[model samples]
Target: MSDPRVAEHMPLLSKKWDTDVAKKFIASKEQRWARDGLGHWAFLVDGRYVGWGGFQKEGDEWDFGLVLRPDAFGLGLRITREAIEFAIADDRIPFVTFLLPPSRKNLSALQRLGARHFGEVNYDGARFLRYRLETR
Candidate 1:
């Protein structure tokens, strides 16, 4: 996760990373991915890590997202499509929510995936638009 290029798109992350901090972040993600197969997974292309996408569950809410490098922006819609498909395939996931900053408004993509705007939320001092897609 130390790749600065990839972190450019994450709106909530405001600080730069040091070596130790980066290692800890990676370790934390590894632990989560190992625990439930629900944490973020690296988006790789031709063996290169271009971005990441996955879900995180908090109580009954499942928040999901995909962050990709600037050069990989074109892949965003495709990733969104796949994420929706993944959610529909898993019966355990009753629904999936997406959190995005006000600046990154891409509601059309959500509409295309049948996601409805749930509302807005403030997290870590930043406001985000929340959208949800239900499988049932």
Candidate 2:
């Protein structure tokens, strides 16, 4: 998503159950994040927007995040994996991390992508498990 459009979708993308807080974070920072040509991209399938996934700076490392419309959740993981691969192509990104809330469903999907738990962090009153996909 481009800057203004992403900002406009922030609330809808932030829906707790249907989406994820990470989506909202991206939307909120759309302008600053996209200036570098590295930021969230809305995932489109069959010409419809399924969700978004891409690269963003997190702490000291480049991390990735994604979320899909509730109806598109299952297929969304595939899109996320592809996005991760794209992000890894950039030499600036040594490792890409996924921060997931403690949900069995999400954890299972993440594992299927070969992501390994690397750490955890508490943010926005929620705890997130950090999974890393090494690019080196």
Candidate 3:
């Protein structure tokens, strides 16, 4: 979260991520993933961490999420595609959802991946556009 490029897009998380805070946040997510079998993973390229991609349950839907550093921008589409394909192949995941802020101007890219806008939601005092992707 300290990465300026990454923090620029994540307004909510940017302000509070010191070492302890970040560690706790990661631990909480890891715990949730371990217990629910739904969570994201670090995106690595040749052993270098570039970003993260994974799922989180939100209102009975498994929401897919992705985040990449500015230097890794071009790799986002490919990584997202692979993550979607993985989700599709997992029979347990009926569909995937997404909650993106307006600042995330990747609607076209998401559309290309078969995500359709479902609605909007107010989460944690912030608004997000919701989307869904199901097996074709």
Candidate 4:
């Protein structure tokens, strides 16, 4: 997608997140995952920008984040899973972390994806449930 479109639609899709926390994340690029040579990719379905999923360094470990439009939730996960596989194939990131909110809805999905909760931390005023992806 064009940068202009991405810039324009980001706020709209972020609204679907329905939380100020996610909105804050969308507003700041620095907070989202970005790394040299291996960065986050925006997920576009049917030509519309839906969300982003990617990896970045987090305190000695590589962490991943996925933010998707509510309407595109199902497909977003599908694409994100593919992105994770690609990241694994690169071999630069031996493990991936996901910082999720301590909510049943979020925990259930992470558990289904094989993410194991190993710790917790307070970041940006929100307490996050930390999950790690073990690589073979």
Poorest stretch of ten by lDDT in candidate 2: 9-18
TM-score of 3: 0.91
lDDT winner between candidates 1 and 3 = 3
Local lDDT at 56 for model 3? 81
- Per-residue lDDT for 1-136 in model 2, tens only? 3334333433333443334665666566696475655777878899999876677787677778775676776885789778767766878888888777664344777778778999887767667778888877
Which candidate should be chosen as best, given lDDT against the real structure? 3
Alpha-carbon runs more than 4 Å astray in model 1:
1-9
lDDT (CA) for every model shown? 0.78, 0.69, 0.82, 0.66
- TM-score, each model? 0.84, 0.72, 0.91, 0.68
- The CA lDDT at 20 in model 1 is 78
lDDT of each residue in 1-136, candidate 1, tens digit only: 3456555446667667788776787788788778767787788878887788788775677788787877887888888778778888987688999888877645697888888999998877888888888887
Candidate 4 — worst ten consecutive residues by lDDT sum? 5-14
Pairs in steric clash, model 1 = none
lDDT for position 116 in model 2 = 94
Best by TM-score: 3
Per-residue CA lDDT of model 4 for 61-114, tens digit only, reads: 777877666666677457857876876787777778887765424456667768
Compared with the true structure, what per-residue lDDT tens digits does model 3 show for residues 2-112? 777777666467456698997888998899788778788999998989988688877677888788877888998899888888888988789888888878885898898
User: Which of 1 and 2 is the better model by TM-score?
Assistant: 1
Model 4 lDDT at residue 91: 75
Native-to-model Cα distance after best TM-score fit, residue 115 in candidate 3, in Å: 1.0
